[model samples]
Target: MTNNGNKYLAGAVSFAVFAGVVGPAAAVSWTPPGVTMGVPLGAAFAPGIYVSNLTHYGDGPDKSITADVPAFTWSTGWKVFGASYSAVVIPEVLKVQNKVTSKDFAGIFSPLLIPVSLSWNLGQGFFVSVGEGIYFPFDSDVSFTTSGQTSGWAAETRVAFSYLKDGWIVSANTIYGVTTADDIGRRQPNYFNVDWTVARTFGKWQVGAVGYGAWDLEETVTNAAVGKGHIVGVGGMVGYDFGGSKLLLELTRAVEQGGATNYSRNDTHVWARLTFPIWKPAEPGEEHTALK
Candidate 1:
């Protein structure tokens, strides 16, 4: 890779903070699956402004969604409890289709704001990080918007850990989310999900296997507590460093659909991500992670 530092930033933010997929039924968690592939979890970052552009296409029975997401991260020199602190914000444009209804809906989805992101290095290439974020709805009503807009506002917590040393990148990130009742008198089920990655760096290329799963934690309007619905997908990722930026491509196929109830679980997802630094200080901030 042209720059090991910049190459890994793609890994650190692969989890896209708070992108969710919704279907006719409360298929699963609000957060989409496989959003964390291609990158390591909680990679230590150098103080700077970094940006990522992602285009995601998802398909399922009777429904599909295409999303354009732009995210900005700031690794500030600020410290929180001995850990380097960072913040991220994301906005999205969505195109959703209902194959059965033969109708397409397009609009902006709720934006995600992560105000508290803290990463701590435990040495030996191991790191732990935590973040708190909110998926706040826009003031205007999007009643015509597809489920891609989700039911209402959501609050989520992110916890991540990564092993980045030598030429190996292994990591896991988890999100636990709960939503408030929407204006329509419905609330998404409380949910838990995880994204995991295992990759090896070879020169300028990184290849790995990635997967994610989501399960409901409580009953919702459409589901019973005994047989709650879930979603799971497994895929592969390939990434490369281009000196000026990093590029990652990922493909994931769903392995489980919530039986005949949640059709959105049976689908395919693809992602193309590009990450680059916008500004860097003359005296670069130290990479909080120490690689021996």
Candidate 2:
């Protein structure tokens, strides 16, 4: 879950925007920025939940193990301005299954992370969303490694944006480690990312191709010590509609970053979710005719 791409802030913004305008159209799936076309607005809203399992293999001297129950409940709805908003709560664990052998031994812990975001649908195929939330380091075991010792607690700030058109979508997202928990005395600087996708829909099916990457910025060193920093990833998703609800299945590979010694090869992960309508469809306005 420490991968900047998996950060709560960026993911939440992506989901909110997709659910608001995309409707039940599938194929392009959650493929951001490159798959927008003929999408309507303000058609859905209801509280739902999402669960995902992620496995990351870093390329370096250290081995990482991130196995946990990462689930979030969301309450989302549309705005009168053709915008959308959501609130989420997620708790998960991170562990170092295999280290470099020469490092001091400590333990792993689970933390509670929450994110809230609001996106504005800027009519005629343009949209944007911005949000701020806290990652409370409630886990006693999550820590900082320095000078043969371990520490705890890290706080972060997040921001994300996306633009849409008939056949393309462009997006950029970033997170900043602005503050630290009491156990960890200092906070790092910034971590950022940019991703783009292009796609088209055919009836109930949509197809898209995508590529994205992340990098460290400012005082932040991209977590090089524990084996992190810079990434290039490419992937795609296929979607289908089951009438009342829609389903999306996705695949992605991490091309670089996540280790200190060796760069990991095409590490893969999958995502799936179900979305339902929260409200009844609005009635179409009647056509006006002059009395003959």
For candidate 1, lDDT tens digit of each residue in 1-292?
Answer: 0111110000111111112232222434545556666556576567888888888988776567787788788889778898889899977776766565565655565678989889988889888889998888553222212233333677889999899888888988899888765544445567788888888889888889988877777743332223465767889988888875888898888787562124355688888988888986888766742111
Q: Which consecutive 10 residues in model 1 have the weakest lDDT in total?
A: 1-10
How high is each candidate's TM-score?
A: 0.83, 0.55
User: How close is each model in CA RMSD to the real structure?
Assistant: 9.4, 12.3
Clashing residue pair totals per candidate (backbone < 3 A):
2, 10
Every candidate's lDDT: 0.65, 0.36
lDDT of 1 at 112: 83
Give me the displacement of residue 95 in model 2, in angstroms. 5.8
Candidate 1 stretches greater than 4 Å from native: 1-25, 139-151, 221-226, 259-265, 288-292
Model 2 residue 54 lDDT score: 29
Task: Tell me the lDDT of model 1 at 80.
Answer: 85
